[model samples]
Target chain A: MTAPAPPSVAGARSLVEPVLRDAVARLDPLTARVAGYHLGWSDPYGRPATPGGKALRPALAILSARAAGADVGSCLPAAAAVELVHAFSLLHDDIMDGDRVRRHRPSAWTVFGRSAAMLAGDALLVLAGELLLEQGTRGGVWAARGLAAATQRLIAGQASDLEFEGRPEVSLEECRRMSADKTGSLLACSCSIGAMVAEGPAHLVAALAAFGAQAGLAFQLADDLLGIWGAPEVTGKPVLADLRARKKSLPVVAAITSGTTAGERLAKLLAQPDPLSEPELAEAARLVEEAGGRAWAEAEAEHRLDAAERQLAALDLPRGVREEFGEIIRFIASRDH
Target chain B: MTAPAPPSVAGARSLVEPVLRDAVARLDPLTARVAGYHLGWSDPYGRPATPGGKALRPALAILSARAAGADVGSCLPAAAAVELVHAFSLLHDDIMDGDRVRRHRPSAWTVFGRSAAMLAGDALLVLAGELLLEQGTRGGVWAARGLAAATQRLIAGQASDLEFEGRPEVSLEECRRMSADKTGSLLACSCSIGAMVAEGPAHLVAALAAFGAQAGLAFQLADDLLGIWGAPEVTGKPVLADLRARKKSLPVVAAITSGTTAGERLAKLLAQPDPLSEPELAEAARLVEEAGGRAWAEAEAEHRLDAAERQLAALDLPRGVREEFGEIIRFIASRDH
Candidate 1:
């Protein structure tokens, strides 16, 4: 029997090869190579690798369609488009964040250097539109518009994140706004594009969007938790990793606004030296937990997850469709890393 | 006294407003605002500015259309798209180049910051697709495919530019290829898009593309000259600024390949401590010119400009259109900045 399956990021790795096989079939050799390289489909020496990524978002797009009684065939363009945007953001974001590793390998920028990585990202973004247009979908206009708007929201969310780095007094409302714009928009875009292909009912589209947005907020909250209290073995970094970086994450913002002793201690710890000693970082994490920041965030994630599930339940889908939607919702909210 | 003549950039600037005003009326307000900001129609602070930019490329597109007997009416959408792509490239290029000013004001990133500037650029790029798709002259598939291909070529050109920046040795052939992909592709697209609208003769369309390409190559070479030797008071940078940046301009590349003593001196000068004393910098420029680098570039520019004119002259057109095209040709080749 298979060992209790690892996280879907592991299980989903197997599916990437099939997805890429389909994608590369459409591109010329050069573009396929470039696209493959950009997606971490190649090894450190740039040889083709076990094709990478969880295919998590693309799976959402396809699953949402099937769950909504729509043919997944029509949603393929949207899936590819969303995945391309995701890869574009990841490449550029690594540069901005100075992230050194991705998929247990050197980041694109680290491998090829910064500018090529940026260009590869640019190429991926441009290729998404090319893919959509090539499909000659009747809904091509809406697809382009949908993807463009989602991309803009992605930038807006990223801008807020960068901007918040310097602001010690950011509000809880501001953190929520940032998370919603950054994560929620893309998730909502996935569902909307899925429903769009189905020509699903307008109310159904609205419900899916709401459900996706809620799921996304839960995902982000969970990520913030992992960034703070997560174990090094699990997270690939020391505990209180966000604290070491002085990241103005959801928990940090919650602490600051709650006016608790832990808030004061956390802020003091953040004010200290380079990569704060692990002990110092742990002190800050303890403060965050004692001040109820963890509980607050956990409750919020639960509320949103439940809200998302409720919206999913409202849809009159067949049992098979409903079960798939339920699994995607659970995966989105609970997945680690 | 005779009226003062309009500036070339100003002459190009004048045609942009009416055309943009018409094109954006169909889009949502937020998108239109973003487009306006990118065109420098809005201030760096994001207020509306006068229709800015030398409408050089779009005017060329319209003139080419008329010469090819396409309705000027039909050319407007394509012109807007071509101009938007041009503006998008300039926005991002300024950030990557660390350029702080544009059109006598702060660059977009200087005012909007990098991510916003980047998003603003991305928005314009995407808006261009939306514009072309809506052009409806050709279907969405054709327009999107053409624009996406052009964008990839443009990004590749940019990548080559960035790649060359730190290289100690770069061939002149490499420089020309970069300039062609970077600058020539857009101009070719402008002419090709006009052809699409004009239903221009296939031979004429092909000729227009060749004319635009040669003209674009010449334009970049001339611009490179201006970057090095033109009066900063006129061009908005210090004289020999490209020399100051140690850029791999055509002249410098030619000099390096020539293997002359002065070329060696120029190369050593580029390797000199930055913040090089002004006199030493001036002496370095003299060495480059004395080595025949500047002259080599000027001759190359002349060759391409001549080829561009011959292409246009061969295009069968009404006498009035031919005369206008000639005036535009002279204007493009002779501009100082």
Candidate 2:
């Protein structure tokens, strides 16, 4: 059984949802409808539906602000901005990746058509900046710069990820760098932008950013593990989804670069032009295990988690705030979906 | 042939090009390459090439600042930011509209692939806000807000344009609003954002914005006319390109809703499934003119230009700045390509 979610996650969601909805409401009607559906605030017909995703990035943003001794109200805009950026990235990435499903539903591009969905994503991105700048403070400008820089890195990482699909071989280092860029940059920004917006000390913001960067890598490693071994119901995707697509995810790259006979055999299986059968997929999974890819990913996640903990330990944050961050770290390491 | 071109246009291009290049160079190599090609600064392979387009938006921005009594250097960032946003929209719009060519060359998506071009557009958008916020002034924050709002409206307008393609009927009012949102919003923002960044008086900013809105509508009207009658050697697009695609451009919509027998014939022709033959396309263009669409568009453009002129006439400005504005207005009204 999974542990209960940290209280900060639920609290952050309640605070950020209204702000996010208000910003989206400012979009044109059709674009707003597309965005509403994508955010899981409603079905395609505009009827209310349960919201999707864990709101983890906004939680991190609010927690960062709290750790900096700022009121929750002061961080709401930053938290919402980060979440909006996350939504924008997912909307565009789904189109590029041709992934038809998101949060167990049809992707926005599939439902609203590619052009409308693309415009909706663009609207959200513009709104994210508008929300931040409307705060009318120096800190708001600083946070906006941080978010923009992170977004550029995120786009670059995605470009590399797509390029990897055409390449026959990818180095483990390149794969790691791609993951850091695609996933870690935004997470690190989310962790520190709220503090920057709160006028927190530079050292504290740096420490929080470092902690988040490590945690984000661990989160990505766990995600790669799930892509190969996750339950379809839990992950909202087919079993061995990454392997089925022959995606150059971290574990697959690690196994291919591992110098063992099993690694070489696994690479050959993936290199074949035809689709892999069920038995072949299972065999490939075994070969990856034999080559120590799974073990390496798991150990790497643990090491990163340890490093994240060290970052917090070096800071003189309030005891309660530190404990809340520790809870989030544990949640990241243990999440199954 | 083009009235020797406006000196302000050349001056603005020279001043803004360096700042624009500096911002784009900050992107990842792949994205930066795509942006360079889209901006006409380089060929697809990154070799230097002659720059394309008139840099009209940046010129309007610089002129706005000058009219507000500020030095051009103080407005450079805002000028570059507006131009970057313009480039960003073109890159994405080319993809959305399935237009394979721009400025006499292959569109960015066609050259770099759609996914890379999309990411490059996304990168330029983020960079636009970054450039503004980096100014570290209250006016910078104001300018960013203005840009963000304009971009949202622009996206919304594009969304409506795409929606119009799927519908059989669209009112002239709907079409006008779409044009205002899609094209007018950005132009108006470009006209005023520079003055805003310079902390110009509220009255001057308002006057510049009004002039830009009227001129922007005039610009779109001219564009619509060119799409039907423009020479391939000049416009870099085939003759009757909009009619070939059955696009519901302002002229086509105006003709269809004109209530003339010719309008009915044009509508029926566009509704047919098969592509229009050359003869049929020419016949359709003739019908649009017979239905008064061409004359209507030309007269409306003149009307808007007159309105734009009155805006400047009411303002107190230096002779040279006013003359430059008048030159651009005349250029807009008389240009054939």
Candidate 3:
């Protein structure tokens, strides 16, 4: 009757939140106040606690470990670490993007001031390292190295993203590289770290990483679509927001590089110095679809999904648990918000 | 004849630079450009490499390991990590403080954009962790946890620093806590991590940390004095720069809280809405001295230096190496640049 709990929801509710709370509880009171508020765990004045994010990364970590035949309780630190890294990225990204709202509320920078948000993000990053070091017995060093490598790629991706804002001529290949580095690498790290914590065989760990990587790319493509076309009420972002900012998302890059007539018109419309009008924004979306960008992105997402499924098949996990991961990927690729 | 290599300069030159270079070399070109320039490894345009900082933290790490009876080479990774963390803090601090010049060159945030500088600092922080993970066999987990704890305290210190800028009535105890978290913690970590990497006895590691903590406090006191009185050409900072910015440095705090006639006058002059004139700045400095702030700080520095020497003597290190660390502390307390 409840539509069957999401694949990893039970484990997340029981295992992840407690570990996360324990780690965050160790922060100094001031830094903890800012972080807790930003995470939706408390109000601006730090009294009432509320539900935060979906716990997607931590759930993935826990599920991956379970699928690898490990005791889920023993891997809670690794799972919490994955969530901490994700939270760290969000806090900094909100500042970099000048985003005023996140999760339908004022962003941390708006409420806590920019310097506090910055320090809170830095604190989360350091906390991630501390969690891994505390859990260093079960492949902690390996997980720590993977997280560092992924963080390097994440920073590179963000730097490239900022650079792309100044120029609209970003190529499709460059966009793909950015997507892999920004989203795919961290997702892959999440899955691989879970397996590492489980002490799974090498082949299984590699397979899970590959699965997460492909799934991550697909998830990004879906997010790009939502950015441009999803209902503002549901997505919590204004419709055609990406176009208004002239962001060179994947579809935009694909259309510009298509060299078709529609692509040319789209590029010309986007090159103007002024902000876009509503009518012009609508036409731009049409131009992208007509230029085959929409088609190409849709097909690419499907292809990535298939590749992820194949990778999952090779992971040597129980059929039921593998199905759970497969369903999660599907949700990522197809969800409207 | 050659000043006996300053305890660990040979180890720094022979081992630390190569490791540091290799780590920075691995960053993506865009991120690497900003970081390399910030480190004084290259010009802003990525030209020939130049010399960088004094390598003080890394050298201290190596010297600590040597005093712990380990081969210096075994601890090079830890040494390089210390330098990386130091550089990370400097890059971020320059941005937060709105400082335009560093080491007589434009700061990284001014040369590149703020975002690039921020990413470069994040990159360096991540690299510090990666380097530790790579060298994880010899006390890798221990060193990683120590660095993470130190970074958390550092962030807390910076957050407190920013908070203090808004309220000028900070207490002396609050200032001391900030100084310990900001300066003493990382310096202490530099010594402890080196000992950890060397797998030194616990007593030796704890003693080195205590010595470094005391010395770090003394170093900050010396820096505060330089900020107020050292010549611009020698200190690379304008005269009374801290006073001009109304910074709550140790001496300034002491003066304001001294409850004397001169202290009352200094407070009234600083509370003005307008910036202080050059003569007002000079008068403020004289008022602080007249209130006994300068004498108090000098005595405190001497007391800390002596305590550091006693801690070093307790380490059971060979007399030569112990004296070398003592001499380094003396230099830190006396250096103008």
Interface RMSD of each: 4.3, 0.8, 1.2
lDDT of 3 by residue, B1-337 (tens): 1123354554476678888889999998888899888878899889966664577778788888888788888888889998888888888888878888888788999999877888888889999988887875747667877888888888888888888888858998999889888888898888678888777787888888888899888988888877787677767678898899888888888888999999999989888989999999999999989988888888899999999999876667765788768777787777654
lDDT of 1 by residue, B53-87 (tens): 57777777677667766666666666777787888
Worst 10 residues of 3 chain A by lDDT: A1-10
* lDDT, each prediction: 0.71, 0.89, 0.83
Give lDDT tens digits, candidate 2, residues B1-337: 3355688888889999999999889898889999999999999899999997777888899988888888999889999999999999999999998999898999999988989999999999999888888888877888888889889889988988988888999998899999999889998898888888988888998898889888889989888888898777767888999899888888888999999999999999999989899999999999999999999999999999999889999999865887787778667656563
Which residue pairs come into collision in candidate 3? none
DockQ of each: 0.34, 0.84, 0.72
TM-score of chain A of each: 0.89, 0.97, 0.95
Using TM-score as the yardstick, the better of models 1 and 2 is 2
Lowest-scoring 10 consecutive residues by lDDT in candidate 3 chain B? B1-10
Per-chain TM-score, chain A, candidate 2: 0.97
Q: Give the per-residue lDDT digits (tens) of candidate 3, residues A1-337.
A: 1133474765575678878888888887778888888777888899977765677778788778877888778778888888888888888888878888787788888998877887788888888878877875747777777788888898888889988988858999999999999999898888778778767888888888888899999988988887788777766678898898888889989998998999999999999999999999999999989999888889999999999999877656765778878767777678554
DockQ of 3: 0.72
Q: Rank candidates, lDDT, best first.
A: 2, 3, 1
- Per-candidate clashes, comma-separated: 2, 0, 0
Error of 2 at A282 (Å): 2.9
Order the candidates by TM-score, highest first.
Answer: 2, 3, 1
